[model samples]
Target: MGRIIAVANQKGGVGKSTTAINLSACLAEKGKKVLAIDMDPQGNTTSGFGVDKNGIENTLYELLLGEAETKDTIVKDVVENLDLIPSNINLSGAEIELVGIDDKEFILKGITDKLRRKYDYIILDCPPSLNMLTINALTAATSVLVPIQCEYYALEGLSQLIHTIDLVKERLNKRLKMEGVVFTMYDARTNLSLQVVENVKENLNQNIYKTIIPRNVRLAEAPSYGQPINIYDPRSAGAESYRLLAEEVLNREDN
Candidate 1:
């Protein structure tokens, strides 16, 4: 079975979607079969793969609502060795729609189980909130990878996220683990960025990835071009950092 990883952070604009897209792409580049699932209502991950999010008939929304099967909803060859379970704005309604369903948090778990054996890594891009969707992702995942941006509010809501993870591990998925934390948008020139990294390392009891994602223009531009950093500019610092991050991730299970 594949290692299911949820790339999640409750705080928005913390490079959650960026990590989901680029890290998955980097893993694919490393000769692994990867499946990137977009659980965010923003649908940026879906569109990042150059897929038309609005026109798609089969999406994650349909899967959650029991209107479609996982196999039927998968968009293949979004990038080489990378498949995607795209999302759209329709996913915003899933929270309300799932309220009445028994074992609602396991819906994604049940759906993803069917496809696990076919891939090496299944990366879920969770919404930037501890909502039903995030809970569903947490329930389905083997571990959680948090992407914390280097800024003033970096640690904000982190305790809540950890508490939720602990709660899920105790009651929902006993096997779930904290994969690690990776710093994003780090600027070497800024003292604040350096301070944030130091504080996070000292405070968070989780492994912090060594490869900090530098704030680079190419990284920011790749999404607008509907491509991963490597595909957009393989020579760029963002691409190199993500590639290194992927290497770190590939060895995480060893640690």
Candidate 2:
């Protein structure tokens, strides 16, 4: 069975989606069958893989609402071994609609249960808020990977996220664990970035990944071109960093 990892962080602009898209691509490049799920209403992950959400039918919204199956909703990405379960603006209504439903947090889990064994990795790009959607992602995930930017407020809302994870582990999925925290948009020259890294290490004791994603313009531009960094510019620092991060994730599992 594949490892279901939710790329989650309640704080916005923390490189959660970017990490999800690129990590999935990098893992696919390394011969893993990857399925990237866009659980965010923004649909950035859907567009990141060159998928158009304008006229697509049966998105993640339908899957979560039990109106569609996981296989029926998955779309193939440009990458050979990578596939995606795209999301669109329609998903924004899921929070309100799912409220009165039974096992609301398990909707995603139910959808993925049958499809989990088909891929080597299932990467969920969670929304920026700790809502029902994120709860569902946490409930379905075997582990959560948090991408924390190298900024002043890096650790600000971490406590709340950790608390939520704890609650999910206790009440929803006991096997759910934190994979690790990755530092993105890292600027080595900035003392503040260094301080933020140290602070995270001090608190979590798991400092950060050795592969810090530098603030590269290409990284930001890739999504605009509807491509992952690996496909946009494989030799660039952004692509190399994500590939290294993918290897780090794979290595950690063996140890």
Q: Evaluated with TM-score, which candidate comes out highest?
A: 1
What is the RMSD of candidate 1? Answer: 0.7
The residue ranges of model 2 lying beyond 4 angstroms of the native Cα positions read none
TM-score of 1: 0.99
Among all windows of 10 consecutive residues in model 1, the one with the lowest summed lDDT is: 246-255
The local lDDT score (0 to 100) that residue 31 gets in candidate 1 is 97
Best candidate according to lDDT: 1
Backbone clash pairs for candidate 2 read none
For all candidates, the clash counts are: 0, 0
lDDT of 1 by residue, 126-194 (tens): 999999999999999999999999999999999999999999999999989999999999999999999
Q: Write the per-residue lDDT of candidate 2 for residues 1-255, one digit (tens) a residue.
A: 889999999999999999999999999999999999999999999998999877689899998888987778999755879999999999999999999999888988877777787988999999999999999999999999999999989988888999999999999999999898999999888898889888888888553678889889899999999999998998999999999999998997788
For candidate 2, the 10 contiguous residues with the lowest summed lDDT are 202-211
Cα-based lDDT at residue 68, candidate 2 = 89
